[model samples]
Target chain A: MNGTARHRILRGCRALALAASMLGAPALACTDAPRGTGDLGLIVERAAGRLQLVETTGLTALGAIDGLGDLSHASLVYSRDARYAFVFGRDGGLTKVDLLCRRIEARVLQAGNSIGGAISQDGRLVAVANYAPGGVKVFSSDTLELLADIPAEYEPGKRAKVVGLEDATDGRFVFSLFEAGEIWVADVREPRAPRITRLRNIGAQPYDALVTPDGRWYIAGLFGEDGLALLDLWEPEKGVRRILDGYGRGQEPLPVYKMPHLEGWAIAGRHAWLPAIGRHEVLVVDADTWQEVARIPVAGQPVFVMARPDGRQVWVNFALPHNDVVQVIDTHTRALVETLHPGKAVLHLEFTPRGEAVWISARDDDKVVVYDTATLAPRATLPADKPSGIFFTSRAGRIGL
Target chain B: MPARHLELRHLVEHDCGSCHGMTLAGGLGPPLTPSALEGKPLEYIEAMILRGRPGSAMPAWDAMLSEDDARWIARYLKAGTRK
Candidate 1:
């Protein structure tokens, strides 16, 4: 708020829209001041398939929405009134964006290598978890249109690749197939006659999933073995439930370099904290006895253990020479309280929709370093470019972001 | 182009573009284009970048790359870095 105090509030909203259009009154055509995209956010410019509209209350960078095609592995969602923003990418595009009109109000491509997306439980659908001709499409979130395709064959013609796309609670969605270790659950509540619910084997190569934040537990994450499958969405006939099974049992795991993102798990109180696919740990389960209550050791392989929205600290991050560090723990002394380094390649890390501050991107130091969740310090750095995923519009009302 | 080959072309554009595809055109690792290594063999793409891909999640960068940084990231991913 400097530059002469934001140029005196944009010169007092252009002098109250030039004295209310010289006294005939017809200003604010839509908005210019008093806006409220609830402190917006976007940031995934992965090598310039752009999008950097931020605002966590002005840790500034409010606009830069390029064509957004193959964003290296982009991922987005928000619009339960967070004023639109769908994104997805990895060349399968699917855009939508309109975060207070910063552009891209609809773009499609739809599939041919994709992975990531979800926004329904009634936000009028927006699925999208594909991987070059694999499955799940369901659109129409205010007109990205294509309402439901659903292919992930998982056997017949062998399709598979659709991992952990969540959105539970009636409008259903759930996901995960990764070359068919199965875990479907569609039911888009008739978003084109949906009703699926598969679930088979549920192991090997699950490679990413998550849905608990009260949208009941979905939890995939099995990169071809050793732990984590858990479905339950309030007992779907008690089917898939492998939880921490043989966690690196005979050891020899470490060699992952970026994959752990079970929807950035890390709850804190009844304990959750996941991330250990190839060690450098952080496990600690028992979020109501899914068991295995402690592993913790972190600094590398754990790409994001998150939880700082008042669950009292967790925040991890690493993969690739410990991707320029950022540890923190202390969910009531689960240990390691503060490591930081925060730059060069750090990648994602959100929290600040009531967690006071956490941002963190850094993608090889292009910038974005906030912090200050109760004095973990460095509060504010902004300057993203190669940034990979930093979402936010307060993740539009939560539930499995 | 040595600044350590521009830091090995930024570790093959963001550490092998984190499982190839910062336009290498594949995710969960597969397309390291040059027409997908066109009939493979630049020492089998530098032995899958210094001994990796054994039953998959392709790791072994021979402990952070070498052998001329995996033969200069297999000739800058078979001469196609800006893909």
Candidate 2:
């Protein structure tokens, strides 16, 4: 074929890809968006007493649902099956919405005061991190029924406040207790009656914990006490091995000075990329050997760290000072790749299962921004009223239940 | 006067110690003890009660309590705990 004919053939293939994505079903529309490459979406935090779904296909404003009043600190998670998206409200209510049906099917009252939650890989359970009266509630995926309310066991003379929860690949759940400086592990195989096992004295305050893909180890981000705590899940009794410390050096620890330190961590391949929020950089540690391999500078206040499914590049979200954008870094070279501005207060982010697009919750704007992965351009914005926590389902053709 | 002190005591037990220390000794913030309130004058204490200590976790009680109610809290913290 002639050179011009070959070029025409490539362009024709690209156009077909775009057209096929547009014609895909609504449930699969989210996956069609570029993932690990940075395509984003918005989950609007609607005003108190109302619910609204803003379709991001063309960034058009969708209608609203009334009666779900002023939900503060709302976190959303779509099931693995993608049949239902559970919205856990701060007021202790869990609103179950069917994305395909485009309506709330059932509302479970008082699913516990939640900051956010993680849905199981199998879509069997939704583990909610209760902020107040610290604990977690494991709810059934299909019925949205409350199965377990596992409270963090407070040590003698110590107060424990549950800050975050993340589900592990192995039928277990990890809960971070901020005040107690501990992470509690619970066996959720039974769901209803979970056995709580305390992993104590991890750090000054364990703010967040993330399990590896294989669920062999758990790494927690300590807020006040800088650095990450690596816990051996194989032996939960031994507690965490203090691997890395002084995440953002030069800043004094909390209760002294209020500069935030280590805030978020993401596991990519054999490297654990940690966002040093106070220092405005990211620290990469070899996951297997657990040693600092590289340190790369990034934009201001990198809070949330997310990676591409292929572990090629790591994305960092800068949260404050009116510059809400994501910084992409090359994992191999540990170099700055691109900086794409999404919106204000980009608190939480997630990539589609297929690694095509990235979705971010714009807290200040009450909307979700979806960006294309390849171009790193803002593709679409989903209108949400005060949307905070956002997650995408791995299921191929199902929307939220 | 004793009845008022008793009521203030009850309020301290239920409301004050919940976030602060159980004995008003301080949990999330400074204690409510005499030492914690020392150098803080009666009027200053009243303002702190109504407006709350800024930059700290202390939330303003202007919406929850009135001026007189705040004053009562000040008096209780200063004198009512004296027995």
Candidate 3:
């Protein structure tokens, strides 16, 4: 609807809300009638190529929508209004889905192979990081219309696979090249005319990268080396700095069955909790200095070391044989306080807006386990069909999700 | 088959299946169904598993799986059977 229509509707809602207040029908207050996007979330049914619309507060799945081709490695980004979700699939399917209506508004197969995607700071543009064509494609978030296409070419005839496409502050999108060992920042203020800034020789096989929640720093996790490369967006000319060098020096890293997700790294009070790739430890880095402060050992190779919204605890889930276990760490003390065995093959974990409860998806068990964070007890378990990623609409307001 | 091979099958169906699709019908990776593998050569299938398609998301299993192991997985995938 246009602005005038939206304004008229808002005026009507306010009048109704005022009338309800005068009648003393407290329950009918518009303020209490689901005003925020915090209630909605999405559960990815990987095998079925469907998305389950979930009511996060009630721990109930409303329903599932299908025809999303190749949802494996699918990631979702909500529009600024949180009314629509942009679902990026592995088969290059970019779908604009309506959350309220439970339907796909538009979809287009833009590439042969896509890893994941990101939305611009303003949420006007959505970009997909492609593996096959080795580039990033920018789309109009509202229409899913193609805007700009930037090929990640490292050599004369070689295009590098783009990964870790994240939206930093300003109108820029930052991403790393897995094969090129470089990080490039694309400024898409004009959409049609994008300015590219490339940082070379950052690190070997920078598997994935993440922008800090404040959108200040971009850190890339290296696969071929021990340490990670960091870049300060404010001072891009300082060059890339290598921190936490030789982290895996003495010991041989066990075979990595699945690449650990770097987006899972959490920034809590004073420190950032990062998963040590191929190791059963959570490396705590001093967020201010970007130095390794401590390492808290855990059950297995940590894939998702997510901090609660309150930043009081860091919840961790592992990879492979240890995926069944979920561990909670007290961020203040930096100690493992609780370990819960939710089910088999726990693929992902998501916390509610206030961090009162957490929802975890166990693929093999085919159920999403919800736990009360304070009580550390099971609150509810929702059955799903081979679920993986659980994304909340609350992520819409966050800077780097 | 040995117990180790059984474990390998579990890994393929669950671990690799994380992206390849639990039923092996394909997701991020191509479908490994019997009909999909009908015309593909046995050697090509095995090599694909062992070396992987480097430019794509598929990682080489050379560090983790042996040639014999890749051969077994290739045959099993060609058969398109899942537990």
- Candidates in order have lDDT scores of 0.82, 0.62, 0.84
Among these predictions, the greatest DockQ belongs to 3
What CAPRI-style quality would you assign to candidate 3? acceptable
As a whole number from 0 to 100, the lDDT of residue A255 in candidate 3 is 48
Q: What TM-score would chain B receive for each of the candidates shown?
A: 0.29, 0.77, 0.92
Best-to-worst order by TM-score is: 3, 2, 1
lDDT of 1 by residue, A207-311 (tens): 788888888888888887788888888888779989788888898887886677778587777988888877898888888988987797887788878888888
Model 2: CA > 4 A from native: A1-42, A46-70, A120-122, A156-159, A249-265, A361-368, A381-387, A395-401, B1-83
Candidate 3 residue lDDT tens string, A82-181: 8789998877899998665566779999997787888888999999999878899999998889999999998988988788899888899999998899
**Lowest lDDT 10-mer window, candidate 2 chain A?**
A33-42
What TM value does the first chain of each candidate achieve?
0.34, 0.76, 0.92
Candidate 1 docks with a DockQ of: 0.19
Ranking by DockQ: 3, 1, 2
What is the fnat score of candidate 2?
0.00
Q: Which candidate number maximizes lDDT?
A: 3
